[model samples]
Target: MKRYTLSSLITRLASFEEALAQKMDAKGYVEAAERARRYASEIREIRDFIIVEMTLEPIETLDPMEFLDDAANPEEVDNLRRRVYTKIAEDVEPVSGELADLLRRLSS
Candidate 1:
């Protein structure tokens, strides 16, 4: 997996939002789209970098996203993982039942 610095991730999100807003602007929401585009452009202007690439295989033993915050509890941790994955991954799939059970048990 490719890992990125927080600023880099934020910048990527901003860029995506800006692109979407610009597309919507073509669809006629000129004012709202312009504001969104501006907000996203400001965020994208931040200095950012990708941090590293990691192998998190076996999908069971090693923690895949240990780089994320540790202070969050079980549910928050899961939510954070899901949200970040949704934002960053190019392809995603559901976890197997056994893996899901293992994760739930581990979090508890």
Candidate 2:
């Protein structure tokens, strides 16, 4: 059986998101956000590959602006952060699972 390439998955997802972003409305914003969350999940899978293969931390540091300590409204900003992270995490599992399986196959 042929395997799907990570690059192909990412390109297809990005193209879909770009197309969806063209619409203007609350629905479009929601769709864009959903796509972004999926992209973030794919990013984390790529991060895992860098960590596993190159032995490196992918992100150098968190942006201070993203945190409560730096935001004007700490609670609101923190809540938003939590929501975004949660959404991204929800999308991440399946992609990461696929990556893990690929890695296992490579090693075996």
Candidate 3:
């Protein structure tokens, strides 16, 4: 299975919301309304899973240079990456079973 980052999922959800808004503004009322409802449901599920299951704390923005600093350890970075991947894989499954596949297709 492909690995997914929380940031990527958040970005996709933003894009989906934008597209749904545009559709609603366009002439496709019925279809757009249906899609909007579905998107809302999906977003709710993701939010609930993140908040309830993961009990995620507020994310802090880190500078790339901080990770790339001369004193930064490679092993530590690898360990952090593995932990993030494991968390995403475990937490996202209950909310969206097709999330990994959707992310793969989107990237492709």
Leading candidate by TM-score: 1
Per-residue lDDT over 1-108 for candidate 1, one digit per residue giving the tens place of the 0 to 100 score = 444443444445465445545555666666646755665664444323212233222221222334334323334434544554443332211222322332233233
Error of 2 at 45 (Å): 9.5
TM-score of each: 0.36, 0.28, 0.33
Off by over 4 Å in 2: 1-3, 25-108
How do these models rank on lDDT, best leading? 3, 1, 2
The per-model lDDT (C-alpha) reads 0.41, 0.37, 0.41
**Model 2 per-residue lDDT tens digits across residues 1-108:** 113344443343344333333331234455445544554355445544533443222222222223323322323333444543343333433544453343233223
- Return whichever of 1 and 2 wins on lDDT: 1
Alpha-carbon shift of residue 25 in model 2 (angstroms):
7.5
Higher-lDDT candidate of 2 and 3: 3
Write candidate 3's Cα lDDT for 8-75 as tens digits.
Answer: 55554445444444545454455544544555455545544443445223333222222222222324
* Superposition error at 48 for model 2 (Å): 8.2
Candidate 1 yields a Cα-based lDDT of 0.41
How many backbone clashes does every candidate have? 0, 0, 0
